[model samples]
Target: MEEDIAEIPHYKYYFATFKELEDKVDQIELLSDVIGVVTIVQDLEKSTLNSRITSCRNVTIKNVENKELQVTLWGHKTDLFDDNVLKTLEGPVVTIFTSVLVKKSLGKPRLSSTTSTLFFVNPNIPKVEDLKTRFQEDVKTIKFLPSAITTQSSLNEEKKENRKTLVKLLEIRPKSTKDMRFTVKAVIVDICEKDGWYYMACPNCMPPVSQADVSWWCQKDSFINKSPLAWYKLNTIISNQTGKMRMMIYGRVAEYLIKEPCIQLVTNHVNQDKRKFPQAIIDVIGKYKIFQIAFETKAIDNVAICKKVFDDETSEATNNRHRLSPPINPKTPDPKVSVNQR
Candidate 1:
């Protein structure tokens, strides 16, 4: 059996540029093998199918030629780049994904990993190093930052455009979006983990960043920055009357949900215990909220898009809309402010 396994032919991978994938979107007739660096990692999709939960992540990769490609991975493959796991890559890296189907969804071209798809991350290969070098230079020129959610006005406009009708959390089913987004109403049940609710990200690309010997480094962007910027990235388990699942709230929405800017939160928790979360952030365990979602082809789940938190009280505090916005441009962290990069 061991010899038989070793005898199986390794599939050949053809490094591709996003330009080669443009016309191939929206149809499975053209399958591809592509390589690039992780620029953005969107939230996991909230769904369980085939008796197991499959989560999806929306990723943007910069190819060797400096072209960007959107790749979606569903199911267990999403774990390949989890916050802690990808750090093992130890520095900047690139991904080589094979046998993915290209399709267009939500106005963007999407490449999804199929059952036969296999992905190699930060592999020890010469071509991968070249790709990493190219990715590093690309980050220097591009604003590789956290993804921004649709603003209230834009979301309202999309609704006016009549994209899709709202649905309950329990009503979500496999293969529902047909490459469209979803909107649902739910309530917060509990926080998943409070310790790392906010992460220090590279000021360039906002992937969970870490400290290196001389400067901070971003694994996804494949480069090192002078300092790190703290960003709000939360994963909480929420529910409707019928069902519950984990969802992600990021950047601006996270500030709105937590009611605290990430800059302050990180300042307060720098030397604190890792197991405890601030009571302020913990107080929203029972609030009702509305959300918009996009399909995660990898997890076969959906990522929460637009969010509006509702409170029971009729007070002015309850009526205030979220005022925080992601910076129009990435800002360098103040040199005086201490960043806990462990």
Candidate 2:
């Protein structure tokens, strides 16, 4: 004799945003399902590194209850329908693969489906509020997936790594502007570590000279005397194998790197020793050229000079070539400042 099996009733669920569905990851079973509307569809082709390979389509669907979830279709599913399918699919019943695993990032849980996961469209799902109330009751029985929740251990590790990579200075070439053949190097001269930000000054301007505000004035006869000299802001992009990041450098740092206020050449006499200014410095301004700047990551204990130069000119040039100071000692106060009584 054959045994009779009972059929399970399909429960209706609704969600408005992706966050609502995240907590329900544990309650869903392999055969459990949901009905929702397709809200967004993005092309993943550009995300792929290779040209010859095609990528999957990432779709974000919102349930009748306004719950949002992500769906990725691979292989044949990519070409199964057009915009018409996307438009019509917004207001109906749909079966989702609940057996699929969840991927967690930054404490958020995201659903991941495999090739075996299936989806079927049904035109009869509840329209709005009615679907929402039904889902609220059903969510009570849903449990939180242990694997989906981000643990404190993982978050601590992430924070530790980020602390090490806190960028002091970033360099990038500007787009949409003419390539200023001049290479710009920004250095972080001061930092408010408490605020998680640092101050940069242009290398050319040096420190004390460039650290002026609008009120401070220069006495030079040229433009320096006519207008208030202040530090400039630089915007650029920096990237590595992991990804690209944008940074903004301001104040003294910008002035130091661009050497904006510093004149490049001096005048000399043509026949005798009379002064005749050379244009070499002016011509090199904003000219694009390649140069490298080294950043001191940590402190060095001792210095050993392998080669010694007795000539002043050669020694000065050599010193300039390796001109980087050790990290500032936080505990040491500047000796130039005199203590004032209250």
Candidate 3:
């Protein structure tokens, strides 16, 4: 097996980026093919009422732009994927999904396998190498700005808070950032676990930063540093009795809500209990909280319409921010001045 494995050659599997998929997904008929590097490949499972047994896997892929799309494969397709693309691993397995169906699942456009769908496990494609070359540059652009922003720029962003609209999750328009004020009175119904709900990042830059050659790199400050100052990117599913949506709470705010740097909880999860969720996340789940939401319809074609949350909490929800923040570190200014708590 070792001698045969070495015979496999590097291949390319190229296809559309998430943005292209998003654009053509609406036409459905026109979305004849889809492709990208699969970052995550989940396990298979079954459900009741169907003796044949339904199997599926959720896949997240990124483009040269670092834009991502979620895809799910079912039944025969899943079996095929597991047998071919997954099993044919000679090295770092690179597979490309092709001729897929674009469908709406939970309000998001996800690619799925159709009768004509095909799989290419590390085929010779130029675009694949192009993707590798561009991935780093794109990560820097999407997750962090190579150049740091001025303190004045930060102040101006804070000033825009007054002009932002205070509305609900259900009322946002596509690409309309102006006059967009909204908030949601939501209860955490479920805490999802695809990426373990939290991500490591740089504090000041809010990084989805990458590590290379045993060193941490932050495109925001263009610096290499250690792990002293870090934060999280939190993901949760929230519901306001009226509707439910996926909410991403970024660092600082997540720190404000979780009450501690998430690293502690993550460490506890890793060293103490691998199967259980961290206590901090458990505490927030099922709790009533208010979120100031931005209505960016361009995201996943209005997937649940809840995006870019500011840390503003409503008085009607709960006055928990105070308890969430530590006494040290610069005191958080009261947000009540600009927002209606309830």
Q: Across residues 134-231, which tens digit of lDDT does each residue of candidate 1 receive?
A: 65645532223443443445534433332333345334563554565555555666666754567776654467776677777677766664456667
Per-model C-alpha lDDT, please? 0.61, 0.35, 0.54
Estimate, for each residue in 195-244, the C-alpha lDDT of model 3 and write its tens digit.
55565465334556677677766777555554534455556677654667
For model 3 the local lDDT of residue 39 reads 59
In angstroms, how far off is 20's CA in candidate 2?
A: 9.0
Worst 10 residues of 1 by lDDT: 315-324
Cα RMSD to the true fold for all candidates: 21.7, 24.3, 21.9
Q: Which candidate is the best by TM-score?
A: 1
Using lDDT as the measure, the top candidate is 1
Global fold similarity of model 2 (TM-score) = 0.28
The lowest-lDDT stretch of 10 consecutive residues in candidate 2 is: 302-311
Whole-structure CA lDDT of model 1:
0.61
Candidate 3 wrongly placed segments (more than 4 Å): 1-168, 219-223, 226-229, 267-276, 296-298, 303-342
Task: For candidate 2, write residues 163-202 as lDDT tens digits.
Answer: 2121322332233112222222222222222322222222
| Every model's TM-score | 0.41, 0.28, 0.37
Candidates, ranked, lDDT: 1, 3, 2
